[model samples]
Target: MDTTLEELYTQYPDTVKKNRKKHIVIKSEADVACPQIEANTRTIPGIISQRGCAYAGCKGVVVAPIKDMITITHGPVGCGYYSWGTRRNKARADSTTPKDKIYSQLCFTTDMQEPDIVFGGDKKLARMIDEIVAAFHPRGINICSTCPIGLIGDDIGAVAKAATERHGIQVLAYACEGYKGVSQSAGHHIANNTIMQNVIGKGNERKPGKHVINVLGEYNIGGDGWEQERILKDCGYTVNCVMTGDASYEDIKNLHLADLNLVQCHRSINYIAEMMETKYGTPWLKVNFVGVEATNESLRQMAKCFSDPELEKQTEEVIARETARIEPALEQFRKICRGKKAFAFVGGSRSHHYQHLLKDLGMEVVVAGYEFAHRDDYEGRQVIPTIKSDADSKNIPELHLKADEKLYREGNEYLNLSKEQFEALKKEVPLNYYEGMYPDMKNGDIMIDDCNHYELEELIKKLRPDLIFTGVRDKYIAEKMGIPAKQMHSYDYAGPYAGYNGAINFANDVAHTLTTPAWKMIVPPWERIEEPDTGKQEGAN
Candidate 1:
């Protein structure tokens, strides 16, 4: 009795229906490969999409998390105000190199108004940078331009240069206008470029360690980064820096000196990772710490990268210890959560990463989608070259990068692997490859791109999933329809959901949400009556 996807599409106009059909696909057992969904395209005008703007991607996600920098929004107050402390990128001042340099607690803005917009806000941005330098005396300052500044053609880069010279502090600017791309992905790219140009590779101080590594693409959401750091430290690896989460200015500068780079959330930070490899000859590895198995695998991969017998032995021991500690709780939750159905519509990597945890809970992901993921995210990295650039994508600049002759390593000697050894290493560890969401999903599953509310409502009506995983925007809507919804974005403002303990916490949380007694009372007993069916045309007969 459920409406089919075809029937749902009939409601839209011809062009709209045709375009939307490509984005909504059903997996079939007969298919040799996963169905391709059109991604990184503009959202339909009337659809309520969960996608955030490019500025949100850049300033909010990438730049603001650095605890030591004064990130000033170089436009209207609303842009800066809304993004301030929203992501919950937790930082510990006591843990930083210079304990006094923490500034993630404060929100700085140019607060551009009508007058500023009419005649450019560059002067205001420059003055704000000077004030920040004088008052905070922070290690650095990052200025991000909102939509109006881009429209008015304000030169933020010029202002940054002058401010840097005047204050004798590092100043960087990002032209991450809100409308640059289809979503926040563009802003992420811009932020990465700016950071690479200004912040990275400036420090001379070096930390002493044999297996030093940089944790890239982690924003420390709800202490997720902290948990990851704890596990890595336990394995006897020196975590030189986390890309941005709870990161200090000094930690960022010395990233070039790292032996390796471990990338967690690849979509937002892959640009910097790739650039770092090219510039610094620092080899990178893709890592996922979202699930227990994923964390175990990621740790093993890191150990393999080092190819040290002692490190590998320690990693295995740590894995065994952590697994023993959390197995009982995991088993209990799995028993309670078996056969539950789940639907996920979240950000780029989460739609895939959280699948590992859901499977650990014995839940099946019936439907999944990304708000702003491109082909590389949904499909694998192999499709990166095949993907044609559109106007929106083309608007974002790709910086011309050349190797730093002094810093770049000449050969694969850093990897400590010969040609034959490297070939054998792939069998033990996956390097420079990402088999995306498709390979993980099963037949009869659904995959969507840039999923909107209408599609979600329709899918909910048809699938009647037991749990929904998405952002806060759609959480209440799913709950209103009598389903338990867990937020993957902010982790419902509670987590350390990135290791062995985190996996147990996630499984327990899902079990608790699904087994709660409150859902039984959604409709009272009085409303459960079935209406009597009147015999058709009995009087006429």
Candidate 2:
């Protein structure tokens, strides 16, 4: 018999257990009541959380992906050094740009010293920007302040402004310290706000296209954007820019010009979407290209929003042709994967996004959680109006965006829909809203928020899942417990897993992980006998 979640709650102390219970929920199959999980809170004092700090979220995940920008860490060298090349963010150099280089391939840091920390690191940070400009004449430079810089009260914004004036380049500073908020989520907000204030709608160039779109929240981890872009082009849509990932500084500035915005990762880039809509009259369509079926639905949603009969027809042809190509391989994997149970705990949207891909292979995600998702992420965006901001969230500032005087697009510009028609279309498609992950999940499935090590261990024991999709922090722990764990964040060094062909890649990876004979070889310490004082093995080959 599997261990019950109620029994796991007893492992914590009285007050702690009470707090943790709210963060967890086992959906009752026949119950009429909806289960709500408390989210976006600070983790317990002593437990080592799997969540990344604000610095990693801002620098590593968000701004660092811009290939044309020189992202300089405005703190100690270690902060920049350790984080470099950790996220498999990829990009290509476009010769059309001024520098025609991918600066994301390298790491640049202020390399603040002991004296600088005590006195101030701002001067050193300015020098570093000067050096970068002299060496590589890149398009722009983003100064990302780490934990130490924030503590020392270094004015990175001032330094960035001076550098911009002196070097004649776009230099923006991000105060995304690790100590900013409860988790990396705060950093995501900061990065989004910074981009909106300084970058978006600042472009001087425009491309001619009817079906133009800005693919936001796609950081191109493992070339995921390339595959997504290929399919979008096949459906006859001009990709204005893939936000951050494989995207140039010059490219992202024209984000306001897109007829539509296809938002992929809502958690990281939703701020830009909302602000852009307010300023430019562009409606964003929430999209998930992680799975084959979800990708088809997203494309269909895009076609619906545009209301172009010819584009809609072309989209249907692309979907039919691509779905036909991958169906055979999907079936082959389904044979080995059918009825298999999987567990997922990813950073933000991937946990929910990958569930669709797993289902396509005839596998079920029995348990899932997000490392740093808010209540709106678990429940629908309807809950956003009801949610009250805590102190941690209040630390970050909000952007008060208004309609752009010159470039602001009116409602009828691209949509070409009557008031009644647009209202009717929104019912079928998520025009400017996200329904969240709750509706898609099975009734009896588990949802966890900011899951800790102890909870993950208990889930592994109770669920006994065939596979675990998680981050690097918890991957080996699950693997040691004789379960196949795949690092979902970085794709475990494999990918382009975001579209038609990418679906097959995901299925193939799942098939390999499930059938790998190695996980069975792990003999957990708990499973071993009570052999006392000796360091020798009991059953030696």
Candidate 3:
């Protein structure tokens, strides 16, 4: 028999159990409202969490992916060194291109020392920026502060301004300290604010295209961005810019030119999407390209937004072509994978995104959670206003914004339809709607917030899932216990898992991981042998 969540809570001490119970919940059909799980809260000390710090969120996840800019970590060497090339956010640059346009391979750092921390690192930071520009002559420089700089109160913003004036290049600084928030979510917000304040809207040039859109929050991990762009182009739409994945500084500067924005990972980059819409009058839509069904739906939505029949026809044709190509392979995997149980504990958006793929593969997700996601991620954006700001959240800056008088296009043609027309349009494509994760999940399934290693191990023992999807840190741990685990964050260094081809690749990978002969050897052959009457005779003696 399966152990109940209530039964599991009994194992912990009084205080620990009380606190943990709020975070771990099993959905019940009786509850009409969304299940409340304690999220975006600080991890209890002594529990090993998979959450990354705020600096990692800003520098590693967001800023580092811009291929043309040199991202400098303005603190200790370890923070810069460890984050360099850690995430496989692949960027393609031609050697034939100018030297100033490519700098993704380089890891720049101020390398703050004890003395600098004691006084201030402003002078050193300014000198480092000057040296970097003179040496590399890059298009821009992004300075990210670590925990030490935040603690000592280094004036990185002043240094950034000085450097920009001297070098005649775009220089931006992020005050995303590691201790600012509970996790990397805080860092994402900080990065978005900095980019909006500095990089975006500096240029007035608009790339000529009928349907221009920006694919936001896509880091292009494992060529995911490349695949997404390919699909968009095939559907006769112009991909004005990807938020950061394989992105150039020049391309991002003209983001205001795009007519619409398609948000892929809402948790990380929704701030930018909302800000852009308010400032540039570019409407935004939430999109998921992780699974075959999701990709089809997202494409359909894009077509409806443009309200172009020709574009809609092209989108359907591409979907038909791609679906027909992979249908046979997907069926075979589904047949083999039916009735298999899976668990996912990953970063924000992934824990939800992978569910669509898993369901397509005929698997059941028994447990899922997010490491750094807030209540909005689980309960949808509708609850954003109701969530009370705690001390940790209050520290993060909330920028006040106003629409550009010159650029703002109020009641544009695309959105100028009447109430009845808009309703009909929505039937073909959803607009400004996201139902969140809990509503989509099964009633009995477990939904946890900020899941830790101890809870993961305990759940594995009870659930005994056929497979697990999480980060690299938990991969071997699951595999050691005789279950196959796939890294969803980096796709275990294998991907393009964001389009039609990626859906097929993901299905095959899941089947291959589970059915591998190595997993069968976890228990010795002798362990399965029956000793017959010999055990009874020994007991008699």
TM for every model, in the order presented, reads 0.94, 0.96, 0.93
Question: What's model 2's lDDT at 415?
Answer: 81
Superior by lDDT: candidate 2 or candidate 3: 2
Query: For candidate 3, lDDT tens digit of each residue in 10-70?
Result: 8788988888888877877888877777898888888888999999999999999999899
lDDT of each: 0.85, 0.87, 0.85
lDDT of 2 by residue, 1-541 (tens): 2247778888899988899888887766675444677988889899878988899989998999999899998888999999998889888765445445678979998888999989998877887788888988888999898999889898888888899999998999899999998888899999999989888878876667678888999989899999999999999998889988898888888888788888899888888888889988888888999999999999999999878999999999999999999999899999999999988999889989999998888888878899998887778787888878889999999878889888787654658788778888878887888877777788789888888898888888877899999999898889888989999888878997899888998888889989988977888667978767687787976
Model 3 regions lying over 4 Å from their true place: 1-3, 94-100, 414-428, 523-541
Query: Per-residue lDDT of 1-541 in model 1, one digit per residue for the tens?
Result: 1147877787789998988988876777787765677999999898899999999999999999999988998888999999889888889874454667888878998999999989888888877777788788988889888999889999988998898899888888889999988999999999999889887999876668778888998999899899998999999988888879988888899888888888888889989888987787777888999988888988988898877999999999999999999988899999988898899998889989988888877888989999988887877888888889989999988877889988888325566778677678767776666777887888878888987887787778777899999998998778877778999888877787888878877887888899898877675223467767786765785
Q: Residue 379 of model 3: what lDDT?
A: 83
| RMSD per model, one decimal | 5.0, 2.5, 4.8
Candidate closer to the true structure by lDDT (higher is better), 1 or 2? 2
On TM-score, the leading prediction is: 2
Better of 1 and 2 by TM-score: 2
| Backbone clashes counted, model 3 | 0
C-alpha RMSD of candidate 3: 4.8
Screening candidate 1 with a backbone cut-off below 3 angstroms (N, C-alpha, C), the clashing residue pairs are: none
Residue 264, model 2, lDDT? 91
